[model samples]
Target: MLREAPAGLPRQAELAATPFFPQERYQCGPAALAMTLGAAGIDVAPEALVPQVYVPEREGSLPPEMLAAGRRNGAFSMTVPPRLDALLAEVAAGNPVLVLQNLSLPWVPLWHYSVVIGYDLDRTELVLRSGTTARTTMALSTFEHTWARSQSWGMVTLAPGRLPRTAQEAPTVAAAVAFEQANGAAAARRVYAAALERWPQDLALLLGLGNSAYAAGNVAAAVDAFRRAVAAHPDSAPALNDLAFALNAMGRRREARAAAQKALSLGGPWQEAVRDTLRSIDAAPRRR
Candidate 1:
């Protein structure tokens, strides 16, 4: 039987009212985001970025064969084309969306992630979530290609009624937020799907789903999810660290180290776990 997604952690709508990072460069993970939701008394299931395995936090090492298998799975197997259609449909309905895109290799250069927070129906432009990039509007035609290279993506809708209580009011958006706060992985996934039906480019939803997959023991699924999250929003520390951990868990020390270092470079509370994992690797004895 397909493992049903878990539920009952904290809601994501509460956090949407105000993003976790006010600094404007960091992106959060589903687990970390859920923790934040918990801090505010909201519940939502935290997902995983990779399959569940006994990863020694103190060593940050994995069995070599596992790494090979993970790499063999590659990045394309995780792409979902239908999801994009749903996302666009949501946007057409005038809902906000967040999409997380990912690249193949860590050393492959370029900013790895981006956020599709909103759309420009009139200008036919995509309002990106680039922290410091002066250019926010990308022609829809241009974005299509950009999105093509992205590995994973998700969408979040606003719950109009839920938002008014928090100073936000969009039914679709509110429903998305309410679904996140509903407290279960299954419900969260449904909400995520609902939001994506119109806006497939939702960062929070992608990250949340990635985290959920990871927790549910789908390591590769989690990695692909986070990869897309990072691709859509380069500065998302949660995605970065989570990806590093996934790599590490698969025993890809070199890639894991690189991912961990990159995550640290991005800088955010979300990097804390990755940083700790890296430190653990440093203290481990090399296999001669």
Candidate 2:
């Protein structure tokens, strides 16, 4: 696999500056998460994340908890694609990937988390910040064996507006929504804006951006996003409904009523919401 590595990715690369944290028994999850969040410029320590991710009875952190902790610290946390090439691609792009492994047999599982910061295709080895080791090297084949046990589960934590090299539209949008839930509208706005740049006509991205902007008190920006969404998908009732709401918020009741009426006429599942929007526009005081 190394012999025919993907083009543009260096055959050998290491993120020497990535921070390392030694795991305190049953705390590999927090330590690995700290290393990943640190690389993304979060500056949080593993000890600080213990309460957020560590599970005392399970003796380890679950994937969802680990991801949530990253989001709580203002990072865009996402699960990497379940493929070795995808994982290495993120590393080559300078994003350290947090991976779960089962060092023991599947029947007698020993779950652990580690950060992969580099890979040497020439030597067929992957470099990691594992346990108490600042740098640990494992044969590519051996690493795959342990990783496969966990179904190749891996994650990448990144600063807002940054994306994994192998990011896909659906998953990226999903992650942005999750980040919004964990963080706030402002953080999610950045993510949605960044994704919109890549996928200009994506309905979900447009809606997310509009919703985030509206939630952040930027009604004008939300209206603009919804307008674009309506242009891209003229028949989208949700888009029209949102635009109407924003327009009403801005005191453009006349324009809001027009948009809401159109949305109600074309409504599918959003019929009720469109009706509500139209009613709100009607109830709004007229500007004398």
Candidate 3:
């Protein structure tokens, strides 16, 4: 049996050791990368692709069984700083790594995972296989620092001990999109919270939280979160649309209309959603 790795949240030092890539966004973290790699027959389990620590208010060690399970299943939860260099070396050796961050106004902090696919030796760059990109090839070391300090940077590494033969079973991109679209506010809130815990500056997650809050009837919270997201990434279409919805929910019709217009100007698949929201707000009956 494989000796299990440690269980629980990763330390900062452990995070620094993972390798990086230049083509990927620092926001996705590691788990997303792992899923892609797993689908491609690379090392490690999809869940193990990133370090997701469910560290509650209490500080306690992880169970031995859980640790064993992680190791057996090719997953690892680690720390940062001291482990940084070593982790990078492993990743440089063809192993993949994932990182997560947490920060910003939150109903809860959420986790975002991405995979490190390759690196540049001459440029000290990290390559990443990311969900946000159709192209690969990215810098390594630069992403390391960005990921480390951006909200919260949690890291994990996968060894290339095995290869795949046949097809792999993994979540499809379309399926993931559908899941997010169909997921209820409560579920979206949980996912957003988990991701935000790792990346507070993540505009997408923040906007999603705001939308989810609005959907769940927490108008105030939705507005607050959306405002923060817009502050971080002003050009974000999702943030614009979600903010418009939040404003409308709060009875700020003028501001909501302006926000919807801004979203329309941004122009994305979200344009229709923004337009629909604007029309609904305009048609809503005034409460006595």
State the C-alpha lDDT per candidate.
0.45, 0.92, 0.50
- lDDT by residue for model 3 over 4-30, one digit each (tens)? 223321221122333233223332433
lDDT of 2 at 264: 87
Candidate 2 residue-wise lDDT, 172-216, digit = tens: 989998998888776699899999999999998899999999998
Can you tell me which runs of candidate 3 are displaced by over 4 Å?
A: 1-183, 286-288
**What TM-score should be assigned to candidate 2?**
0.96
> How many clashes show up per model?
66, 0, 55
TM-scores for candidates 1 onward, in order: 0.36, 0.96, 0.39
**Of models 1 and 2, which has the larger lDDT?**
2
lDDT of 1 at 245: 76
In candidate 2, stretches whose alpha carbon ends up further than 4 angstroms from where it belongs are 1-3
Show the lowest summed lDDT stretch of 10 residues, model 2: 1-10
